[model samples]
Target: MVIGRADLHTHTTASDGMQQPRENVRMAKEAGLAAVAITDHDTVEGIAEAMEAGEEFGITVVPGVEISTSAGGRDVHILGYYTNWQSDDWRGRLGSLTEVRDNRNLMIIEKLRSLGIPISLDEVLDEARKQGKDRGTIGRPHMASLLVAKGIVDTMQEAFDRYLAAGAAAYVNPPRLNPFEAVEWIRQAGGTSVIAHPGLYGDDDLVEEIIRSGAEGIEVFHSDHGTDDEVRYERLARQYGLIVTGGSDYHGERQGVVFHGTIGSRTVDAGVLKQLNPASR
Candidate 1:
């Protein structure tokens, strides 16, 4: 079958993305995407708006959330798709997680301030607002945007490499769930859990372990993955009978990583989507 256009990983104003849901959908349609998933960091609030916009733009919007979890002292992001959005259980879990995220962000800001960076929580929130991002639970990408606004660093990678990297002067680890717990929560919420950007983590064994712990898929086609890493991850997924997925991990201009439609070629197939949500089949 000919591959169709899809982007399983994307952000919007509901998280740290520069575009609003409507604008994102419009851009996706313009870019010739058949489907897209708004996998906002730690929140699914953008799904409804994305869905509405998708309907208007004649594209499919997959409900998704990127949950931050921990393993071996490193952060692992698990993408949850086709979740039960209205479930009280899901809301309670997300509320608790959001509180943890907010506290973590405040602590990071305090550390940055102590280092004489002069960044305030209000400044971060203001930056997010200026970018049309949600203010309730600001993320590092949003903070990095603030740094960019102040000319601290040219890009998000530089912001992290200079100050926010683990063991850096202003670095602090956030409270996080274990990988198993994160996958189980996604499963309980009636969503498929996929490991996001394994290439960034540099641990193929851990990816296999996550699949063993009920993660249904692996992100094999990420913008950051080199050709060899992509081939290796694809082989691993096939060896373990896991669904293969990919995306640009788009965060708009904040990261300066890649363009919105540049990574459109990497997409989860419709059969994989059906596997993610059997009802879709």
Candidate 2:
């Protein structure tokens, strides 16, 4: 059922998403969503701009962040909603992640150079600036885009396929938070921690462990979810008594969904928002 008007997961140039903070808000309105979260990866820089745009566009902007953590040696994303963005602890936690990101960026560039890729961190940063992604934390995508610009690869996808993807020549595993630590950080900042895109993990045992890790909710509805995936996650939510959260996981064209199209793509029900942002409710 299309029970509510909230997309609790989305991104912007604040991290790796293609759209800007304000642009995503305006698009949320166009997509008929009453609320959208600015859950940029490891950064809250776009939250304020999104809230301001929400005011202008008549959309509710939920302050959120997607923390990248590792589980079973693989990357798992945790979505923190209704956070105290200004809290020192919150800011500090995210800031640390950015440091890790920066270090990883340097390492990745070094690896690329070792592979005779003829790339540099400065060139990647320049490409990111050209794409307006400089204001946010730089990531592998920026490096991939740089490869494209330098004609080292024809597209970001090609860059990933050949060198940057996991197990590729230039791939480097970076330091990241573990699931439990991430959940504790979110709860300490007075935010609800959620498991993002559980379908991608496909590990039922891992789902149970995440709940035990203190995750308050699971992303049961997502633009990437098929019917079976939704059903599976919905059952998991019910089994664990967890709040059912959903979102488009919008990342602009960089992802499968559009900036605004995600509103129509997934349904999270108004009740979930009430639980996530009781103050707003």
Candidate 3:
């Protein structure tokens, strides 16, 4: 089989991404992608819509989710691919995570309010509705859009840089699973767990620990990594015998970075997908 051009990581309205799933797929096809995955942060609500859109656009859609977990008191993201989205295990885990995320978002909102920014949950929800195109989950991107709408920031990056980023005034820590526990959960769900954007985390030892925990892959290529970093991650993946994956980590216009198919880019090889057997999940 021909190895199609694929981006295994991306987002949609289901999480912090700006576009709806259909729009993401349409853009991916226009960008000459043969396949794409809607690995939305902490949610799989958009995966079905993405798959439907991919069928029409002739881009194979991989079901995926970017799970937020904690390790050493820091947040780590794990990308789970090819799991049964509707399974009881998946639902249970997602429900628990959703509660954690919702609580975290509320805390962020309260922090912003205390800072005198005063963004209401209703306002955030309305902003999400405006961008959601009536599908998928609403998230931080929507809140950022509300900030933009209120003239708080010129762009999403500016919003994050000034407030939402770590160490920023509006930043708040969210509850999450530790890396080992996250890997175990993914394995239990019959999915492959991968460390997302290892370069950004800036800890090689942590990456090794994650691999030891049960992570089968590493996102060696990503929009966040520079050329040297990509090479380093590639070398690490090879050294650890890990499956390598890459993607744009597209969040739509909410992020000012390169488009969905534009960064540390390499297509997902067919062999890699074959290795992610759904039957194991």
Candidate 4:
């Protein structure tokens, strides 16, 4: 009988997600959600449409973005909530990061080619185009799809295992923000920064470092988190006096939409939103 009212992490066609912004809103409404955060990766392109659809569908849309950063040699995702997406200053920042992402994709493809994988940028673009993902957001997952299409890999996991994963032959570090930089940018845009899925990252020590890095909140409810993980993060949030947010991290069926009816099988209420961003209330 538990109901979900908010999903603080999600994606749309503006990034690697399968659905368009408006369609994601519709899905949220259909699931009886009152609010959903469109935390598209590195780009705020989908926010406008999602907000528009939210109005039409009677759902509250939190304008957010998931900025990819690196710390301790691991990819860390920082979620920004209630951010001002219309400012040129903010857009310029994301634009630069997107440019870096594009360059990194090319480098990865070059490494793959060098490794005799026969994967090309064009092939990856074709897969991303089919999925309707944005240009700046083309990533290894898109490349993996091309590998599958070419029968070079059996699955996306295999593609990553053989080539794209960190420390793999094709791996290359891209331009990235440090933890502090990521938090600063979100705050600069008048948003609250939250560490996305602490459990997915390294040990509790690293999570503590992120908390100290100026993140105002932490994601406690995620499809990737189990009960112990949730409890651990919740305790950490309380201990550190940081806001607690939750979401399904919904990408789509292709990304394995296991928590379909709820946001990671944990209902998020409006109080968490208010805590994370007073403006959200």
Q: Which candidate has the top score in lDDT?
A: 2
lDDT ranking, best first: 2, 4, 1, 3
Better of 2 and 4 by lDDT: 2
* Per-model TM against the reference: 0.92, 0.92, 0.91, 0.92
Cα displacement (angstroms), candidate 1, residue 53, comes to 0.9
* Candidate 4 clash figure, as a count: 0
- Which regions of candidate 2 fall more than 4 Å away from where they truly are? 1-4, 254-264, 278-281
Model 2 deviation from the true structure expressed as Cα RMSD, one decimal place: 2.6
lDDT of 1 by residue, 101-164 (tens): 8888889999888878889998988888887765335788778778888997888778878887
- lDDT value for candidate 4? 0.81
If both were scored by lDDT, which would come out higher, candidate 1 or candidate 3? 1
Candidate 4 lDDT, tens digit per residue, 1-281?
A: 22347888887778877788998889888878878888888999999999899889988888899998888787888999878789988999999888888888999988888878787787788888887775448767778778888998887777788888888778888758887799998988999999998898867787898789788999998888889999999999899898888888877654343322233344478557676675644
User: lDDT scores for all predictions?
Assistant: 0.80, 0.82, 0.79, 0.81
Residue pairs of candidate 3 with colliding backbone atoms: 14-137, 70-177, 190-281
Ten-residue segment with the worst summed lDDT in candidate 4? 255-264
Per-residue lDDT tens digits for candidate 3, residues 151-239, read: 98898777777878777788877657787887888888888888998987868899899998779999987877889988898998899
lDDT of 4 at 62: 81
Clashing pairs in 1: none
Model 4, TM vs. native: 0.92
Worst-scoring 10-residue span by lDDT in model 3 = 255-264
